[model samples]
Target: MFRKEYTRIESSTQHSSVNEFVVINIPEEDVEPKQIILDPDDQPMWESAKIVAPTPNSAIIQLDVDDNFVINSTHLKMILENKFDGYLRADPHDHIREFLAICDMFKYGEMHSEVVKLLIFPFFLCDKAKTWFNELNEESIISWEQMRRAFINRFFPPSLFNRLLLEIRNFSQNICESLTEDWLRLKNMLQKCHGHSLAKGVIIQIF
Candidate 1:
């Protein structure tokens, strides 16, 4: 009976060791959690994750929902720590352009859904724009590209784009402007009109 009890106790110990709970020690300060992205060349790409357990020299992270992993703490970086509010406030009417630039910065960061959630919140969007974003189906915006297209369609209406094109066509240099200054001004207008790839000959003719 003693031997049997010892065997059972040993088995329980082994079982507990297999599924041990690890405690994450995040700092008391309002530090944003560090985001982790797997190596691009790695097979079976891992989802972006945030450090939940800040153990010394290492971190415990949860990938998506159930996959918990251990990684060196140094591997993570804080990209969104200071940029979110500045970018949101930079262009009240042109959210799409700012959103695209943000997406580019965090492309491989693996925080697409988290970033999108922040963007759609009332605090980030303007009063008039909030209603339109609120009505969107959350599940449909799984990727950054999908989110980008939605913003573009809503903000950049067909009439607005047409007006911009007309402005480009009717644009002319100001009186007393130097040749170089005029050329630069025309190029700037072309870019704003979304003619980034307009031919040099067309630009010359406009000049």
Candidate 2:
């Protein structure tokens, strides 16, 4: 092996009292494979550089922005075609948080990876939420039941209603360890979120 192993070191000493570091050294077989495994998972791990809507109407930032946050009106109109449904279209809460972090970094020129978790978990499963869920993961949101219910709700036709309900109920039971309120919130939130088809279209089509 050209490189014997990959090493990771983590440290925290900002308080000026003490510093801490954790390093993981993994045996690497091939440079290419190691790089593949480390290339941000071929997913959106929100970086300030990835913020495409610089002043809006420029490029696309993966997360949706809405009542919780506002993008430049020009960009909003460009993407949504001026017929914004409402705050219901508010960029998903977690997404807004990530973008705001990027905005902060842009304004202040600081980097915060604290929410990188917010950018990774959703795309942890690629079948749903399409490919953009991880643009930000400041909040590590994992409500398997919510995801299950959402999947069934979107993919299950009326014919599978009973099975869908059963699956949801079972998911709720398994995830009871989390507070009922949080799970319900996630379920309700997912219930309100539009399906992945919301914005995947040619920009010119909307314009």
Candidate 3:
């Protein structure tokens, strides 16, 4: 019942080669449905991807990698069917749930009290990070704070990080209101940190 309205099965055509590239759309407000091109290098991982939809009746999956049926589309409906089948096969609902659950976990970090134990630490995977870690005796320990800082300063726009913060906030104010007790606590924490910038200079590697 979670995210009943935010998930849908997808439909679309796909490349026929084992190593073909495939891209799919993501439907959500304030977020452009970007197509993710998956190459053969990621085919194995793609097999495990979960699908999600923006509405209860919508299917975000075009094909189910696990399905035994093989298809080569010759008509518009067939192509659409394959596309939809792929998305259905991906089972994005699971991913949506995972996304929402993570939001809940980070949102109510205070309630958990053992926040440090639950944090996804960051260890730099770059040259500058190598030198920085060398100065820190290569301990390789880091924190979410470090990840946020590196991402904001060295990587993509702060918006990327901010989007995560916003997701948590949206969950707290609009989504959390409908959630149960455990979810409610998580939402509270999300609301508190939704707009705050992360701290800096700590490295804790996440496995």
Candidate 4:
């Protein structure tokens, strides 16, 4: 019965570029192991593939026609489930705030692993981030947490805090700037700098 079900799923999925079979009720020994398929649409590939080996949060897949590729587990899962649909797909550099908001949304949904995967995808990563990502040895990254930290460190280095602090300290109304525009700019920067804790005297001096 299990084999029959598995064969049916497999036959239906063969024509598709990616495939998955949900195993159920089969005894461990009797189950015909089907290699996991990493969707080719997620990344450009010469051919479709079947998982040859899995390590931690990634897998090595051999293509049907010929070739091999390594893909992260979270990415493979998302591809199989069609969860990558409707993503904002912005360039990370030009749309840092937008990408960060998307990341936060995913984190709130408890999909941290998927967040890292989405950020690192070539289509989503900015030119600078793509260069950095290409330089790293993919196998060395063992977890989503490490990937997230590396990405943040690359784009939002600790130096940003210092820059923000300097901006806030030196903020002043320019002679040619409208008072309303200046005040709004200062308020926004202060929010970024989290300046609510600054003394009232300092705030007054800036104003």
Would you estimate the TM-scores of all the predictions? 0.45, 0.16, 0.17, 0.42
The TM-score that candidate 3 achieves is 0.17
Give the C-alpha miss distance for residue 185 in model 1, angstroms: 2.1
Worst 10 residues of 4 by lDDT: 57-66
The clash count for each model shown is 1, 10, 37, 0
Instruction: Evaluate residue 164 in candidate 2 and report its C-alpha lDDT on the 0 to 100 scale.
Output: 38
lDDT of 2 by residue, 84-183 (tens): 1213233343343443344344321123232222222233233234332333233333343343344334444454445434443344333455565656
Tens digits of lDDT, candidate 4, 98-194: 5444444433234344544443443444455555666675455555456656655665555765787888888888889998998898887776653
User: In what order do the candidates fall by lDDT, top score first?
Assistant: 4, 1, 3, 2
Top candidate on TM-score is 1
The lowest-lDDT stretch of 10 consecutive residues in candidate 3 is: 198-207
Q: Quantify all predictions' global Cα lDDT against the true fold.
A: 0.44, 0.34, 0.35, 0.50
TM-score of 2: 0.16
- Residue pairs clashing, model 4: none
Give me the runs in candidate 3 sitting further than 4 Å from their true place: 1-152, 155-157, 172-185, 188-207
The CA-based lDDT of model 3 is what?
Answer: 0.35
Error of 4 at 19 (Å): 54
lDDT of 4 at 170: 87
